[model samples]
Target: MNEAEAAVLIALLHARPRKMSWSAIASEVALRGSATALWDECFPPTLEGVNDLDGHLARAWESLEAWRSEDFRLLTVLDRKYPSRLREIHQVPPILFVRGQLRDDEVAVSVVGSRRASDRGRAVAARIAEGLVDRGIAVLSGLAEGIDAAAHTATLKAGGRPIGVIGTGINRSYPASNRALQAEVAKCGAVVSQFWPGAPPQKHSFPMRNATMSGLGRASVVVEAGEHSGARIQARLAVEHGRPVILTDMVVGATTWARDLLARPGVYLANSTAELMDLVDQLTRTAAGIDDWSNVLPDLVDH
Candidate 1:
């Protein structure tokens, strides 16, 4: 099948009957045939309870046509526009619902922290975002309150790209206040989700959102986070995805998560914008051309 057809098929598969594991989807695609042929040749028992082959295929096609009628774009793993870096994650989503745009080669850095950020923390997050944009890096964040809001606003103010990886469906707003901000991101950058179009923002959805945030970025910076902050989990997941995690001196001194992250070899500590930029340079170089990001980004710092 074509990429779009395969993508829609996967999207429909997840929407009904039951959601299959991402690895299973990946393996089926590896069979080197069209998705329709794969489905025909190997109908897993998972869908047997729902309907016969013809019935299931019809439902899949119907759902694909329905979603296509909307503005949302379903990207399957087989799509060329699908992000390579995100595929490195342990539990990659088989289908991503995108409402805006995605650049295959842009350098993005996720800046995140507590929803209940201190005033100082908010200021710092904005500063970091501004700095990242000055060097032509896109600012990535969950479109939540506090630090996430601060980062996205600063990115927009700087006329830089802001990628909002959200928990709720692409059409729905989470945290409510970010409704406008999310719209702006869709206008100039991207607002993406793996959830169905009407999926609500459950407590569990945030972690799923964080994983996508961590996966897309070159690295993640935690400006400020309490001990129980979700940013801490994002930082951990970033490291697991083979990206460096940067924390401010303030964050490093604030909680056990920071202290332990500081002990990790790939993690780095920064106290100022200058230091953060310096660390970014050092880490990218030491990553042994994890990507030739510096060469590709002429507007980057030190370029």
Candidate 2:
């Protein structure tokens, strides 16, 4: 089978009958060097009377074709189109369903915060997003309301790329009201999801989405988050992924987690937009090899 077909099969393995976890499948496939080989081993055609598995595979294949017809692209770890930065993370998804385009060379930074953001928080998010765009970096975020909306809107207004990584299936929109915004992001940049095309939003999916968002970006900026916010989860994941985390003064002052995270490497606190932009500049330069990366944040260099 071709890689694409194997990817479909692997995705199928994660469904009802087989019910294998994605991480387990990813690890097995990586070790085996081919999802097709793994699938064949798991369900040998000669082994027997598995009518149910056969039906499920057929249905999944049909869904794959339908998704393709609707302009959705399926990218697996086997595909070169999968985001390289994401592949470096431990929690990398086995597959990604994408609605627009994803360039391997795209330089992005995630701007995340609370869904119930304050006016100042929203303004800060927008300014940071605009500054990121001005520096030619793509803005990445969960397509939720409040701070995420502000950042994405600012990025679009600046005529910059806005990548929306949603918790729901790429074909579905959460909060429902952001459907148009999601479509716009898909048209202007990309809308990405790791779940099946028909999967609905679940309580646990948002944190998973945050982990994926952290993996996709070179850094994550927490504009404003409460102690228990999803942005806080992303901040923690970013640090674990060895990516930098930038917390605004407001966030640092408001949340214990933000203050605690400061003690970790690759984590910085920005008191102003200028300071935030300066750190972004330093990071960009460091990434480009134009400057010493260690000098940007001495502790982070070791990671």
**By lDDT, who's the top model here?**
2
Off by over 4 Å in 2: 1-4, 15-19, 47-54, 288-296, 299-303
Clashing pairs in 1: 1-34
Regions more than 4 Å wrong, model 1: 1-8, 15-20, 27-34, 37-55, 284-288, 291-303
Q: What is the lDDT of residue 269 in candidate 1?
A: 75
Write candidate 1's Cα lDDT for 147-222 as tens digits.
9999999999999999999999888998898899999988889998987788898988898889888888888999
278 Cα displacement, candidate 2 (Å)? 0.6
- lDDT per residue (tens digit) for residues 1-303 in model 2: 254555455445655235667756766666676876676666665556433365666666666667667778888777767787877777878788999988889899999999999999999999999999998999999999999999999999999999999999888998798998999999999999998887899999998999999988888999999989999999988888878888899999999988888888678888899988888887866775322222467643222
Using all chains and alpha carbons, the TM-scores for the candidates as numbered come to 0.85, 0.90
* Model 2 root-mean-square deviation: 3.3
lDDT of 1: 0.77
Please tell me which predicted candidate would have the highest TM-score against the true structure.
2
